[model samples]
Target: MAPAGPDHGGSGTPEPDTGTQRRLARRLVALQSAHEFAEEIVLWPAVLRHCPAGDALVTTALEQERQLKRTLEELAHISPGSQEFTQCVNTLAGLNRTHLTYEENQVWPRLQDGLTARDTVRLARQWSGARRRAPTRPHPRLAARPVVLGTVGLAVAVVDRTRDGLTAR
Candidate 1:
């Protein structure tokens, strides 16, 4: 059920026409949306400040994220019980794998190298805070910045979470 990102962990196999599969899909979407929003708001900003050539690295990462969101949008439209849904899930997993590889290999090391232990710890705290307040749904149209995120992002997040609550009920 986990989507690959800071909060990402183990994977799940799709079960046809099962309640578990539906819940898994929903959970994956929510977790990934939150994780990426946090990274864009906090982690990527640190990357821009710390890493040499940070702009290029963040650009590449965002492109990858944009693709992932697009695919997720596709996945949302498919029937979870169908073969197409399984294929979409696999496709998403592949995209997430590539994204994780890039972040783990490139972006993370640079960010770590740039920060002292204390600053790194501070950034982690900020990122965790952002993650907790992040939107539960993907809003691919918005720009990722602390200022914009501090206002419109939080507002949209509240709305999204409210909708998520309604949907869950």
Candidate 2:
């Protein structure tokens, strides 16, 4: 059967060369990077300074970003139709959902309370700058599912080490 048109279901007729899967993957990477940059550089600092018990949440979110970076790296090379690609996408979706929930429910409120509009705008601009300078190519290690998972594990280990250092003092 032919693919359904937009009028038949959602928006419009899908284009054959719209590169939907590639676009989605690129968007996911952009969003993840933006969120990580916002939390690490802007939101976390404000939360740590203004919100009570913000440090733990910031630390947890940072670790989550670190892990996600590794996962993305691993999944970077897999084509969308492959079994490994499907599994990697599923894993990324679950992790992203969880992270979004935590940020929306727990972190956002704290940031809203602490950060002014001006502060947010300034931070957003900084994030945009960082993203512009970020590498465009996918990490080489992400050529297969096993590598992706292994990279995520390594990132988690690094996060753990960082967390330990933070907690040590």
Highest-scoring model, lDDT? 1
Question: Runs in model 2 with CA error above 4 Å?
Answer: 1-23, 137-169
Evaluated at residue 58, the lDDT of candidate 1 is 96
**Runs with alpha carbons beyond 4 Å of true place in candidate 1:** 1-15
lDDT of 1: 0.85
Candidate 2 lDDT tens digits, 90-164:
988888888889889998898778777898798678657644433332232332222432455335435544653
Q: Which pairs clash inside model 1?
A: none
How high is the lDDT of residue 42 in model 2?
48
The window of 10 residues in a row where model 2 has the poorest summed lDDT is 137-146
lDDT of 2 at 7: 45
